[model samples]
Target: MPTMKLGYLKVCVWLACVAIASVILYTVVMLSRRPLSLQTSRTAVFTGGHLRLWQPMDLHGIPLWDLLMLYMTQLDNPILKNATAQFNLTLPGTCGENFHAASQGLKNISSYPSHFQAFVLSMHFRDYSLLVGPADDEACPDGTQLLVAVKSQLVNFDRRQAIRETWGQKGLVRGVTVQTLFLLGKQGPGDGYPDLQALLQLERQKKRDLLLWDFQDTFYNRSLKDILFLRWLQGHCPSVEFVFLGDDDVFLRVDALVAYTGSLDAATQRGLFTGHVFQDTAPVHDSQHKYYVPESFYQGTYPPYVGGGGVLCSRAVATQLYKASCHLPLFPFNNIYLGICLRELGLVPQNHPGFRTFSAEAEGQEDLCAYKELILMDHRTPQDIIRLWRGLHDPALAC
Candidate 1:
């Protein structure tokens, strides 16, 4: 009986050894299959030889499940790929010969006196006659206290209407004169609506707030829109004290912004270009991104730039930027192009606590006050804009 018991014990020990060995082999295989490059963050936790990782969030603050989705989708989604490829094909060659050889696309062939002149001349110099200008130019005049220029699409009539009702209403805000204008470019033939131009004309007659240009309104041509607006401003509305440049999708607290600007002394306001600024950001190398910059185009780090969702700049800075734009090549990214202009002018963008580019994810009712305090908030739909405007202005609601 003692011998049998000892033999059973031996068998149990052998089984335990085998089980431990199997676990070790399984762990090794799992580790070998795991992707090393996927660990973008250093905060990964390793447990039982398996890595648990965190991913960066999207613009909406949702966790990105796949890091390569942006790249993969470019290839997988045919419509998106075709659109992006068409834009890429239109991009002019970089300053280097290698890029010209590699891309074999549009080449810069102007033989100007200097590089600056070459850059300025290389841009498509088509003069797009304006379809509409400020209707009551004599009312606001050149000395308008604040001029708000909104970048808008041709079909965003609802958003433009929301603006007219809310903060964009042209009138006295806090004893300051505020004028708003919607800026747009011509719709391309592929936009599928032949009557868009006629509709725009009708809207212009009714509103008299549209500043339509004749350039093709593509996502990549946003910089052209900005520079052209600058040129127009220099000629048409030169004496405005401050200009609020923003997108139509943003919600602007015009009253708050006007009060803030009015509080500053005249000298302090002249040289200011303040917003939510990005510093030490590098150009994206991933070809899948809309804002990607190949090494042949720009190899250096991007200069600090204010978020284009909204920015408040003095007339002085705008003038300087316009001059700089004349010399700098047209960059695909409008905000980054503005950064390049600022770099050329030796001006740095100031960060304002009130300018927020991120969505306000409120924690409670009290958090609504935070939205009231911000100068601008991005990613707001037309409905969201109207709702927020009403909520903030509600007399009974208190923080």
Candidate 2:
């Protein structure tokens, strides 16, 4: 009987040993397949415009479940051969700051063959104002005092209450201002409302007059419709030094943008338009999409590249663009139309290194975090913006 009991105990000990071994093996496999951490920066650069920073992750050997799932589902996964490509990137920063130097170089490009102003100098520059769509509370620390023309859009009684209850109460963040704009007679295409009228009303009551064209509508309308509105806005806002057209989804690091503008002289800055410029000596032209603009529609050649989401145009450039818009038939595409207008006006589309029309997800910018340490535009959800603001609080995670 004693021998029988000893044998059973022996078997129990063996089972326990096997269970421990299995766990060890599983852990090893997971560790081996973990994502790699890309090189990092000591600090983040804040570019001009609504550039929203994100929550910083340690990024070291993080689990790749998301990546793996997407990879398996793809018939032609670009990621399978080079898994975690984004995680292996080398961003620009202190150690050589290669990316930063390259980006800064775009601003320094000289107008080699007698500056462009020499051509458009004859055209009178137009004064135009900007229309910032909506300001999600996440993007603004203090309401934009500069948008005096549209003060009501920023101030809201009900929203003020929500901000305190949702944000201030958590101790996660402080005052945040987000603006929402919409077409007349329509609320918005999204699930939520930001009380755009409240903002506009507040602006009106406060006697702020900075808004260029007050009519409400989505910018995604017909190209001709957008041009008409642009014309009205330029005509009305005579004090507009330059026009910055951007969406509420983005946060322009205003101070950074203003500082950069200060760095350039009036002459150098005039006739200057900057944003992400697509270049394809031979780009595929699709006419059906609203983005399609034919060369025949315009008097001159079709411009090589332009993106619509966020564009910066100087007063001189604005006048030339307006004049050219009339001669050049409207193209359904928002960016291409601007490109054609600029080209016909004999003005060039200067690429700004800081411009980011799309996030790393859409544009395939692998070293996005590092290159975007200082960004003019970054696409992020309002909730995402909240978290990003949180991560910045930790001293170790600022970069």
Candidate 3:
């Protein structure tokens, strides 16, 4: 009887050993499948496994997921392969100092921008819910050819009004339907903003053109706003023929815009993303500058990106861009971030002379004739926008 008991104990020990080995094997295979540490391909080449930063294992954050998706894309597309290969070089401080700590469940990342820190925290806790927006398909009624999304703020009521009274008027334009929406983010008293909530609510009720989200409406959070808007577009206006994204302060020649877009060939229209293109630009390191980028934040030159002040993209491109954005981290500069996503998708931005983001030569001094040919121009005040719109549309005036 004692010998039988000993044999049973030996069998149990063997079975336990097998279970332990199986668990170990499974873990190793999973880890090897995707890189656990979110190191760049360049860093991986140099360290050869020495600097293992603690990237989140769940692949929930945009940065980590983007790295994985880029890696997968590199395997299939040679363009991504070359781009990834060229991206091989470790510059200091791309990831913040507390990256490892944050990965290990600590939230002491004060060195980064407040918006960036908020984005990081949002990875674990934030739904990015829509606070106010179009409630039904009527927002994009039948034959909607162009949807204009203008980024605006609570304090910019005058700009929104100017746009509405001018180029942003809804309904038909040049035989095609055009719709408009003003994108806004929440601002509260805690943020030093006035109590404009009631006024904004009334504005929404009267105009029915505001799309508000539950995020801070700060300069740095512009990228977040873009992402949220893209998500909303995918859900709401996915079938729209084209999209024009710009700021509320810009003057857009709606008639000229319709004419230009209508003239595009089918193929060009399918992938259209036209504006003032910035090519081979480097990130700014000046801390005092509004466009400052820390050396540790990003290391490469900017990809060809259309200016954010005004960009026009086709329905197909808009859809693809939304998909690409899912696999990329948000850059502090909203336009630059879109450029990075374009690089990931191997799409190049098209430069058009009509979209003059940085106003044309002597823009303030230019007569109506100079402005007549322009499609979009930035840095215009409410008065300027109104004056330009009226002057350009005058029936008695000939350019």
Candidate 4:
């Protein structure tokens, strides 16, 4: 009976050990499968000697846990697993098949004769009936010194107002003719903001500064906006001396910008495309990053291109770019795609320190004097832009 009792006790002990081991294994797996939170350091993944590739759309959308699992299973790299755990890095792979499929579609599109022309023509063309343009064609008649095309969202009335009241005001800047227009795309039913269309029309009636296209307004469709803008320019305002392509959020120093452009010789102005040029950058592979690019879409290195926040191109250069864009495949990154257009044109973007796309200084440490000198400063809120515009011209506050 004592022997029987001993045997039973051993069996119980063995079962308990198995249960404990199983619990430990389950706990580890559960932890591994958990997604990394937003609080995880982004810089650690990108900058800490760990190069990560990300898809632009998935970078912020996908969780790090899923990315790590994919890398562990596909790559079987224990080092990558450790790095993903340690730095919480997300890699690209989940949407690879989808991206490949889209790439194939693009390839099929390119297989046709005059594919680029056909693609451009397929974009629904809207006429001046819905446009709120210059009151008179003579207002921007031939020899207009500058035409500032501000890419704006349909719902951002405050931003458009601030721009109009501030640097985007129509008139002479430093004795040069400068006119501003807001570029917009149609807001579709899928956008879930049907009321915004009515408000947009009201704003258009009041401002008469809007340039609308029929394409769906979306972040991914910015390239379409750009192309449409080019086409509009070609059709309507081809004679403008120079074009300033900028975002609505950017603050432009109209006086300073005009002075700088006026100083450039006519020949130099014709071929000029200058801004904060990015060089030696690669497409991000992380699927969660907003700026991510898939290998299937782009396999080559990006050409040197200016930051899209603002770019100043001469009329001739703009025309050349528009022509070049027709032959190239549509790329999602508008600015980088512009670089490709410039590349095709055998031109290079000139980097200017005065175009501060990545902020002029560290946050909370902005130098007003430096800001005053820059032609373009990006990422400012509407109120901040107004304040900056006011301060730049404030006689009492000399920087």
The TM-scores, one per candidate, come to 0.68, 0.43, 0.74, 0.66
Candidate with more favorable, higher TM-score: 1 or 3: 3
Off by over 4 Å in 1: 1-126, 135-139, 360-366
**What is the Cα-based TM-score of model 1?**
0.68
Per residue, candidate 3 scores C-alpha lDDT tens digits across 142-229 of 7788999999998899999999998899998999899999999989798898889789989989988889988778887777777778
Query: Can you write out model 2's per-residue Cα lDDT over 1-399, one digit (the tens) per residue?
Result: 999999999999999999888766654433222211111111111223322223232333322222222222221222232432433422221211122111212211233122222212211112222443333332222332111111112323333232222222221111222222221212332525565666556644442222323222333332433454455445444444555554434434444445556577878777667777865433223545423322221122335555634576666676667655543323435566677566555567777777765453432223334533543545644443344444433466434
Of 3 and 4, the candidate ahead on TM-score is 3
lDDT digits (tens) for residues 1-399 of candidate 1: 999999999999999999988866654443332112222333222445553322222312111211112222232333233433422333222211111111223233222223323333334343456766755574256457899999998888899999898889887788787889888987745866455767777887888888888766767677878888888887766558889988999999998899888888877798889899999888776766766554334444677898849889999999999986654456667888798789767789988989886645553333567787788888777887888878888898788
Which candidate leads the pack in lDDT? 3
lDDT of each: 0.67, 0.40, 0.70, 0.66
Candidate 1 vs candidate 2: the TM-score winner is: 1
Per-residue lDDT of model 4, residues 1-399, tens digit only: 999999999999999999988866654443333222212434223344533433121333333222333333333333333434332323333221122111122322343334232432332222212344545474365556899999998778889899989888887777788888888877756867555767876876777778886656766567767877886677676558888998988888878878888899878988989999999887786656777654433343578989948899998888888776554445667898788778767799999889986544444455667787788888888887877777777788666
C-alpha positional error of residue 70 in candidate 4 after TM-score superposition, expressed in Å: 32
Candidate 4 minimal-lDDT segment of 10 residues: 95-104
Best by TM-score: 3
Per-residue error (Å), model 3, residue 275: 0.7
Model 2: lDDT to the true structure: 0.40
